[model samples]
Target chain A: MKYTILFGARSYEHEISIVSAVVLKDILKERIQYFIFIDSKGDFYLIPQDKMNAKTFSTGGYEKYPKLQMTKGGFLQKSFLKEQFLGVEVMLNLIHGSEGEEGIISSLCEFYHIPYIGPRIEASVMSFSKELTKLYAQSRGVKMLPYHILDKQTRNIDSIPFEFPFIVKPLHLGSSIGIQIIRDKKEMNYNLDVAFEFDNKVLIEPFIGGIKEYNLAGCKVKKQGEEHWIFSMIEEPKKGELLDFNKKYLDFSRTEKTTQAEIDTKWTERMQMAFKALYHHCFEGALIRCDFFIHKDAIYLNEINPIPGSLAHYLFSDSFVSVLDALAQRLPIAHSPQVRYLFLSEIQYAKGK
Target chain B: MKYTILFGARSYEHEISIVSAVVLKDILKERIQYFIFIDSKGDFYLIPQDKMNAKTFSTGGYEKYPKLQMTKGGFLQKSFLKEQFLGVEVMLNLIHGSEGEEGIISSLCEFYHIPYIGPRIEASVMSFSKELTKLYAQSRGVKMLPYHILDKQTRNIDSIPFEFPFIVKPLHLGSSIGIQIIRDKKEMNYNLDVAFEFDNKVLIEPFIGGIKEYNLAGCKVKKQGEEHWIFSMIEEPKKGELLDFNKKYLDFSRTEKTTQAEIDTKWTERMQMAFKALYHHCFEGALIRCDFFIHKDAIYLNEINPIPGSLAHYLFSDSFVSVLDALAQRLPIAHSPQVRYLFLSEIQYAKGK
Candidate 1:
């Protein structure tokens, strides 16, 4: 019953992850047995029992803690540490943005055969990418705003594709970090410059007028040994225009207006329909936070957060811990059985040679 | 001026990778200083200088070769080896399929800051997934066949979107490892069972009759410090009625009818048009191999091999060494600069707290 809560990584949302960790620590305090923090530069830190606090996580100068490298084994390794095993049974991944959310960390977990509590590598990677997510949504005939990709080499700000009054964002960043709404031509350069600082590639999406933003969180639970996904009541964040970094982390409690439990059945049905449609096209991870923009009859899948903050804890019943515990009980459910190569065999090599 | 030719990993195409290494050895033998082979189980073996022949590669029992692990410093480390530093400046990545081409090893290279000679992690991952690749193509108006995804949990062989005469393939495997043509409903279960052996998710694409198969190899080189992509003269493989695993590797040399230097500008223009369009989206890395199907006026992107066989050596010049040298000189061309933070600053954190 060992649990290691992993948080913090090299992302624009580094401190936000720490905040998410603080929230997680509060909810799953009795459950978590160990803590690991990844620095902005991608260094692993094992927090000692005495140093485990919200302040310690926020500050993140864990020079005294043991630095780790993930081997084929699931547990943390310090190359030459006196103690070899840390007895990590399940990894509670609270990593937010960039490396952590973008499937790199999840892939690392997969390569190491660790049971991580989020989307699989492919899902994480696809969800983290705005371009890929939009494309998948588009293929599935999901409503989406017109978007254009501007690469550093071929296309740049000098050659903008969309008209002004467009939203430009870094292709892979989360929590609306490098995002700007260009109202006019003059604001284009500055917005593009700011966006490029986060990612070399930026996605220019046409801004729709009279749009309402709604966030719906989804979770997968096992019922009668079969996977059943549950959707939460939709929340409309009061944050102006866009849910920027400030609105996401700071003064976050008043961020969204959400119902406590069972809302209108029709509303729930529509939300589930949207969620299920996006899920087939690759909106994934164990706990998923999908945002949509509704303008009259049109509903566009705005984006998906694979590693949603505190695993989108507030959306579940009572707290995120309730759903997390349910999901955690089915640990390593996603783990593929031993790969039996259909065409690959050692004896076949001898014959082929 | 150290060059280590790396090949073999846990893929159904493991033996095929060894054959590809043989092809690479013929082309890059003069420049290659060391050779490393990764067995199917992901064990690293430092191939002894003497035991570097095709016979050795085709039959992999390198138990005596020193085991190696990629360190954070971007060099191979063996805990028991006499020499700690391998002095690996540039890596020639030849490992095929799953672990090799799917960004796991590429990310390992990225994490270590090693100059891997292939598509970077993002491009590799995107190209590795058939569903994503097709979706991206669909987004850009790059014509593709009608396809549906069948997940392990949701859909079974009984439920297929495409009508009879469809192709069932493992979504992520390469070299036609788990692929079958389901000509009728009777064969659907068998094909799906076969496809699922290689991957949990399978892509069901409408099989096009009387379609021409073409292989186009693309290379990226630096001239006057400016990036230029070079395309190979098109080849029409003779491997009829689905290029199966045996046809792809064993009798591969005789499969293609490729014009050596120049032919058909109009045709090349059309092929290059498709290649360049895909490139603009994600046709990345030092080298890329894209397969296409053209039936009537319709052209569809079939699949992309991030690390094509022989490094797609044959498609380039008389030898791959020429382009490898040109690309190696521009070591680490894919590195990016600038990391903008939306929030999560230490000074800002202190103030917020």
Candidate 2:
């Protein structure tokens, strides 16, 4: 069946999306007809994944490629794209950050009646904004650091109640684009200015010190009886002093120290509870990585990554489920029902008319 | 500039959007080259407003009419849509309810670098979801009716912690689509079932009896070298019973009542404070109408229409500024500096490459 991999968003994680899409193409190559959406200059191109091997899908090289245009001139005007993608079966979304995580694409997919692998629009929007996500999490009794939201016009940084050694980050940006750790009030202005460079709103949360960062990646799949089955978790031990953008991405030429930390039954149960709480709260579909900080023997959820790096295959590798098997299971579960409904609804409407 | 009036969404207010867009066409025609985005069979058609006039942009007739496919291929192809919306200078979003009010169109415009005349995406999403909006409002000390949220899996409606004569409404749907007044436990299941027809989640709020409904429409515009200026307030006097969807738009057809109502200075000041608070919290561009119920001396905010009916021009008609003047002021403010920055950044990155 024809399939498309949506990637390369107009977001800070656009480059990361390209990498994820490329890796996904390698895995899904034998199974489906895959294409990458490389967003450049606010335009999207349906480029073969093989072509993306030569250059990175970034804003710089975006305009160099030709893109599919939806024109008012009807099918005859842009029949090629219609012929190529209309025949396709499913969409594998590899987009991250802003619109990717905020349910715009999900809504569009719903409008189009296409089957996609990931959270629905409602869950996407709830998870995308840090403020909204935290609020929902708080309502669900999830322990989180106290945060003070600062808007663009916020003038008095000194008057902020949150003491220094606070985490300052954009409310909406992903991949740690405008995240800073302010050590003192003197550094607050600098950090706030830096955070404002990326977004209009900043979330200032009290830094949870004396904690080891843990990256727990797992896949939540729905079985026949409406039961959710969560796979074994993969824990990533935090390397060095802090896990900033470079450290998170291992971009600073540092060989990242990643180990599969053993989870006891008690901690495993706690992790499961957290996952279920988040899943029930509104997350759905495929693999999601939940980042947590353990301080004083308590696990506090940092944030949830709907679309994690490398599709977080390493987490499932040890459990004997290849990334391909997991993808196969997740994709069909995500796509089939939605696609059938679209066709059925169209037929019903046509008959009614 | 090449522009589009995106309306006729899969919203409860789909019909209202048609009226709003049709009326707005007259105001925007001279300055912008616009087309109406008619949603038919889950795809968007960029039809000229003139064509829409000949054939009403209703769901039934939309499929029969020729339309511009917004995507090159079917919905799954992200690249297909990336090409279609290119060069569209502005989008005047008139669609209300789920697709419009929930920030889907706003986020898409932001991702596609298309300027839109409405609230920012974050604010729109926050305001659209009744549960989240009320929670946010409550956090900010906004006066609202005591309510309980009921999810789809909620069993035993009689067990809810609310008194009789409560209003049950689908949490996200706008225009009071599935709103029902439940006088007692007998009506609980019927009301919930009716609300479930529109949405999966429902809100049960205490019905404010013997209260007059008011509509306060205001616009936020930025003048050169100054902060944003909010225009005068317009209050709709309660004519008959409770203000429902039919009563709202079909008010002209009902028994003729006073077209205008007197706004006491104290109430007007309170209304201004609410509007300003909303503006600071999330609202950015265009005009918005806030519905309120005055019970005795207390004012309870009902819901806010980000893109109110006819842009709430009826409210500005008798004010210091004419409806045309208000539109003129509002149109220019649609050119958001923050949005301009996003466009410029994309363009600059493209040029640099």
Candidate 3:
């Protein structure tokens, strides 16, 4: 079975994606058939496994590699008289931020009929937008902190129903890129201006000081003939006003060093139940980490990381390869809605009405 | 501007998409630079303008044309020693169902930085799924008919809170392909089975008998730095138990003959306001048709047609070419989140953490 690792797209988290892919290369080892890197210009390049390192991409040394063209199902390397098929039985989406979490790679995989290991387009859209995530959580009966949206078009601050000490986040960004904590009225305008630089919409939520935040990663996998959820032990992340961009960067770059959070059995069960409610039907195939805030003995969903950095390998107990293998075998088959063209066939035979 | 019309992907509404593209070809005439037809196999073929007819695609005659490759930004034709760029400045999404409304083509356009005249990925995802659309409507404070979802995995009918006389619809399908009106409890199982054949999930809503249904189409256009909504005259479609697959197919095939619905000004303003709420920031730059049900003087959003058949040309009075040109000029510029790789560069220089 051939597996392709796709990473490094035109995103703010391009370097992080490279780090994730590099970490994955060490984990997946010889199972990977191709390391397809998408440059900032959105061109595909086939990087040799031996040359897979941070320097190769950072120094733009990947330009010398064979360029690949995206065809119907998979990529093709155009050379001399024939095009070479970089056979990909399954693809692992390791890109982060915009192109990855926001549904570009998912769309590419779906359009080309390539089975991939990541959030589907619908899940990506539902999870990527901080604004939409709140709606989805509400619909699922998953509790979320009350929030207000400030649009760049209107820039209306009066619409906020809550008091001061708010957390301002760019609506569609990941990796804590454009997040600021506004302690009072004097800090609101400056924080909003910073968030508007990254996205048109900003999500302002009540900043609960020293909130209990837990990160749990899991995925629905099929074994034998039945499907069920495989959940990871929850980790209590160190929190501040928020983990700033640099801290989040270092956190995402860490590989395989994980410690489970110590919590009561009842609380763990309750949090897991909330995760199930959010993950069940919408986020079927993707491996995701849901960050939750335990507020006043009630669980509140902070956000959904559709494409978690390094695929959240450290969270789960089993080896990433085995989990990925089982998932790849039972990857959701896209139902090809059979088109008989019965209507068109009948129209061709009939005369003008 | 080099305008491209992309249509027909492995969708149930493939023929309807062809009909829509043909109608568009006639309307746009010489303004169309290329008509890229995607066959059921998800392959791209450049169909000649003269040969653009129902018979051409039905008889599989399009296979003879030069095949095109989907590159980063646009399509390319490879022959001899060189690849010719198709030169697409803007593209019009004409595909109808799965591939189009499901966010595949939108993702392709977005990833490649091709300015297109259709719904963005977030809008497509919100509108494509009936269940998600309900959540989105609720989030926007738009009224929707109460509904329940039936999943294929659980096949749970016991969870439906609604009584009989329910309308069962496949969650992800357009064109009214697998919709059934259940008048009594006995018809529930059969109707649900039929709807499940089209999609994994089915939405059951109370069938409002003879509901005052109206179709409204519109888009947001920017002119001289001012952005405003351009709404078309509301349309009152002929109602039935439901327009089953055949009637709906015929309706979608019609072109350029429309009548302004004799709706009262107050009702018109209300419906237009609802349309504005649904379309404002979420569905910017795309021309869409929203079908609404007016019951008890309250407008309930039925569903959103992200990529309407015939581009809903008849709904709007203006020529689609001019509307498309205006939209193309002001198509939302995807904010490219800049990455300096300052952290990664620092990591390369640092000896130890």
Q: Per-prediction DockQ scores?
A: 0.31, 0.18, 0.70
TM-score of each: 0.88, 0.82, 0.97
**Per-residue lDDT of candidate 2, residues B137-189 (tens digit):** 76666788877878877555755787788888888877677889999878777
What local lDDT score does residue B125 receive in model 1, on the 0 to 100 scale? 73
The CAPRI category of model 2 is incorrect
Which is the winner by TM-score between candidate 2 and candidate 3? 3
Candidate 1 local lDDT, residue A177: 82
Q: Give me the runs in candidate 1 sitting further than 4 Å from their true place.
A: A53-60, A75-83, A151-164, A208-210, A251-264, A280-285, A317-319, A331-353, B53-60, B79-83, B148-164, B185-188, B206-210, B251-263, B331-353
Chain A alone, model 1, TM-score?
0.86
Classified by CAPRI criteria, candidate 1 counts as acceptable
Candidate 2 residue-wise lDDT, A235-277, digit = tens: 7555655567755553312222245676666776776677677
Error of 3 at A255 (Å): 2.4
**Higher TM-score: candidate 1 or 2?**
1
For residues B1-353, write the lDDT of model 1, one tens digit per residue. 55777787766677677667666665666677678887755667888766755555444457667787656644455564243867677887887787777777776666556776776666777788888787667666678787888986666665676777998889888888889999986887777788887776889888877788788887766789787777776777667888898778764323233464343566667777887777753544557777887777667788877788877766765645667777677654432333333344543566776
Candidate 1 has which clashing residue pairs, if any? A119-A285
Residue B45 shift from truth in candidate 3, angstroms: 0.5
- Candidate 1 chain A has its poorest 10 consecutive residues by lDDT at A334-343
- Chain A vs native chain A, TM-score per candidate: 0.86, 0.81, 0.96
Q: What value of lDDT does candidate 2 attain over all alpha carbons?
A: 0.62
